[model samples]
Target chain A: MTLTDESPPMVNQAPSVPATQTVTLTVNGTAVELQLAPWTSLLDALREYMQLTGTKKGCDHGQCGACTVLVNGKRINSCLTLAIMQEGNSITTIEGLAQPEGLLPIQQAFIDHDAFQCGYCTPGQICSAVGLMNEGHAKTTDDIRELMSGNICRCGAYTNIVDAIQAVMHPQPDKL
Target chain B: MINFDYTRADGVTSAVRDRASELTAKFIAGGTNLIDLMKENVERPTRLIDINRLPLATITETEGGGLRLGALMTNADTAYDKQVSKRYPLLSQAILAGASAQLRNMATDGGNLMQRTRCYYFYDVATPCNKREPGSGCSAINGFNRIHAILGTEAGTPDRSIHCIATHPSDMCVALAALEAVVRVTGPDGDRTIPFAEFHRLPGNTPHIDNTLKDDELITAIDLPANGFSKNYAYLKLRDRTSYAFALVSVAAALEMEDGRITDARIALGG
Candidate 1:
């Protein structure tokens, strides 16, 4: 019932020196190498090591999805994952959701629907929305609510956020 | 937070070997629990051995007509897996009902089993929590103990001591208990298997102790037997909120009925 990753022991002793581990991962189509501590989270590594600050850190704990990212095409809370675990994996962040010239459909829809305010949780919200739209697990509002409940918006933008995602998923002819 | 050293382990063998020699070493996989504990200074490990890169992420079939779930399989993967959904629906539904989509995607099968309780007293260093500091006085016995355990209590134990009776916090484990899963552990000595019932120990008198895992031991995999009766199982979770919240009371039930007569029943509860 309990799910766990198969990682070796990383935290039973005190080390005399800081251990640096090398990791190679593809983020948003860019290959990057990072020298990180074994315990450094993917969120911390992305924000500190790679300097991709679009992924926000809300609860540090797994309760908030402000640090949501895509690993091997699956959405996950980056805060809960260690950077070392993502080696050789493909990662997609908020930065990867669009091209250099314009926004992705989800991002554009959020803009068109005015889906945010203060925007602290926007990056994570958009990322989670993208994952949900592509998940094929959600077919109704109930499913969407269940799937997107992890990403919380303090601005109370749930209505607009859901509307934006729905528009992208079920596009109207006039809107298109 | 204190500064600590870190090591990236290539596989489980090297990680366990390292832990056998280093007393301060601990395994770091999904940081869902370990990182939070470290940041709170509840668990201070100087050296963290990274085992996330090991080849243990797949869920495969065991030789004994059972399912072997790799230690690194994430909660989301297991919950949505076709095999798990068909054979062990309770396990799948329980995993989905507990954490949010994002957390489930990152939380691993092993880390979910190893998660500590969310006792407020245990987290508050200012208060006396035996689970946080063994032998320390308990403060929740007469305090806010509505969430404390009612089934397992030791006689002659002080009211304050009973504060540590918080039940196992994971919904996934509740289903595992009902499914009668087996945990496979790899240690310096060798590999060993423990039934799920014995895997998670009740607080009893020593509420501070969670499980029976040794210092250098690592959970390598979890194997679930083919219980034909489990096909008719279901997981029911009741929580304060509709989503992204822990369970208030959850039930994993497997019922076998012969023409409306209760032939067999397996049930596990978590609150």
Candidate 2:
């Protein structure tokens, strides 16, 4: 048998469909419009189209939380949602988390607690933590650990990550 | 993923009409599952009707003292809803037991019911999967069948020959079945309600057909009866990991007790 890159015959390929459509998204605080293909994921639209590469794509599928972003203040897997579907929603990526004056409290906490080794999963972890705080569900260390379990740290920086989030959730004056 | 035409449906009637008019059109709401399937080439809809704009994102109370969860309501919202957590704690617990927070935020209640199996072979296009392709034969039957269904197999039911062993992979649906929730749907034929137990089907001769939903039918809402078993209920999930993992075996159990004795019991399993 010869090697080929073709898909199976059962897969239906729509060739005559319109290639791309324009969608307006409110990222961080600014609204921008971009023309994108229907198959383009929100992750790709941010990384490739809008030139915002802060949101990492660890797994294009929803398995990895590396592409996690806040949509209207709720964290969602950007890889799972289509870019066109997210139109009119307010999206916040890691790049958008920091303010012009200084870094967000979570970012400073991550740095203070040494929450990262390779730093690939930090963005997602921090964004997920922000989303967790927004939801106001985590009340304890265990709650922080459970709520932030979506972002995986292959470097095994889980302990520091949890500490960083817990510190933010329940801040001690001395620690601060 | 294959390129497809995208159109936003302004209303439920137009959405149904568009879906019914086209054979390969699909409705997209919280595209957590459908997009995953599409990327894997397991699904190829020529046209996608974005149903996120539809007015099916509310949770209302029914006349029977039950709750009606709109189809577009996100799983996270549904689980965290005050009414659901108070009255339907079983459903809330089950929803929380599955998936990560990010996924729960994107997955809809209707999409959760429409979730496909997590069978390894079903996702591998290189392998022959009866669920992915009709009459293609099941690879999980004899190959690494650890996560396959333990009940409702061909060996267990002689009358209904099972062609596949894949199990429904939703933790929320397991609780819904135990609670006897009703699924309200709208189609070209009009509106109807499907009993939760009858919504999902066992993999029989045709494993490709996952649910009893007809073509062009759209799930409008899921109604939970007044009896939510909030006082006595449990959702247990065993998997490779505690979070962000598919369940190897899960159980949603509810009970009605009288004088510390079980009067009525309902249990549903998922994998």
Candidate 3:
């Protein structure tokens, strides 16, 4: 279960030289092109190259979900994936979570439910929640908690986060 | 990070040839681990051959009523695949039990098998880790070893002293070992197959060498035998937390029972 990325990066004293790659991504509804180093992760590409800092970089090692983004309709750790590797993939960050007209239901739900505090991890949590709802895996509150374990909120807003997600999962929960 | 050349592989044959022929050339599939290592200055690859466009991401059936998992198949897709869920449920359960949804979506099957140990000393360059540096003394030996491996261990001289007891940190590979899968590879010498159980070598005198994959070899696919451990299979993951954490120790067990008696069983442990 050692739930690390495919490979845990070991320490090294090897010599390294910078190399760059051009990537074309349809981000949030817009197509963005950037030239970045092969080692530049998707998190960095979005945050630095594209100037979309909504995606936070918590661990930069895939341990934290603060850099979560939707790539082709599925959530993934942006920090663990290289920018060049994601070329041609449509990426959706927290800033793009809303519609052209207004905020997304999940975004509004977070505010309505007060699902965050300090709000540093809010972007990742919101993006992850959108992906979680689309995957349609979480059925119960506990299931939501387990499935959303990747996104950590230091504010201890677990109950409210679950409530917000549950409201979207089963809208009738409020009516009941 | 060191400057390197990047080439998108046109096909499987060319990908293997390019990687095998060139030194310090690695096939970048998901980039989940490769990029991470690059940032830590661990793996200094001079050329990153992109193989994501290759047609090696499919999950199909083999001719012998078995399943063929493509090397580029992401962990999430394989875990949620209808066939994997029905046939090799142990693998599905094991994968789901490991990384989170975001990581699973990006981690590929080939990368999963190629995972390195999570030993703290191995990841901290300031420390002396024989795995990272062959001659570097192992700090974990005298340091904290709560997560050290308890199974298969050996000691060697300081120059090659491989007394590193770091355990494999892959839940998927643990299931693969128990299920007896075959790793298909294409190398400079052409194609070859390796038994799953023998994929990961025990931490012997060479703790640095994680698996049997050669420098130039490229993993093409993983062939899983016909549904053998479907029912009565359980993936038990134990760690500091209930989820989003590596297993301190985990078990993948598939049992076959007749009436009230046990007929056959396969179990593998992971940490």
- Who is ahead in TM-score, 1 or 3? 3
Q: Which is the better candidate, 2 or 3, if ranked by TM-score?
A: 2
lDDT of 3 by residue, B84-138 (tens): 9899999998999987888888889998898778888887778888677765678
What proportion of the true contacts does each candidate reproduce?
0.56, 0.65, 0.59
lDDT of 2 at B153: 64
What's the ranking of the predictions by DockQ, best on top?
Answer: 2, 3, 1
TM-score of every prediction relative to native:
0.88, 0.95, 0.92
**Reference-based TM-score, model 2:** 0.95
Q: Write the per-residue lDDT of candidate 1 for residues B122-227, one digit (tens) a residue.
A: 7677888767765566777667766656554566644323436676679899989898899999999999999999987665456666898887899999998877
- Superposing all C-alpha atoms, what RMSD in Å does each candidate have to the true structure? 5.1, 4.2, 4.9
**Which should have the higher DockQ, number 1 or number 2?**
2
DockQ of the candidate models in sequence: 0.37, 0.43, 0.40
* Residue A165 error, candidate 3, Å: 0.6
The model with the greater TM-score, 1 or 2, is 2
| Model 1 interface CAPRI class | acceptable
Q: Where does candidate 1 stray beyond 4 Å?
A: A1-25, A33-40, A171-176, B153-163, B228-231
lDDT of 2 at B215: 73
Give the CA lDDT, 0 to 100, for residue B236 in model 2.
93
- Grade the docking of candidate 2: acceptable
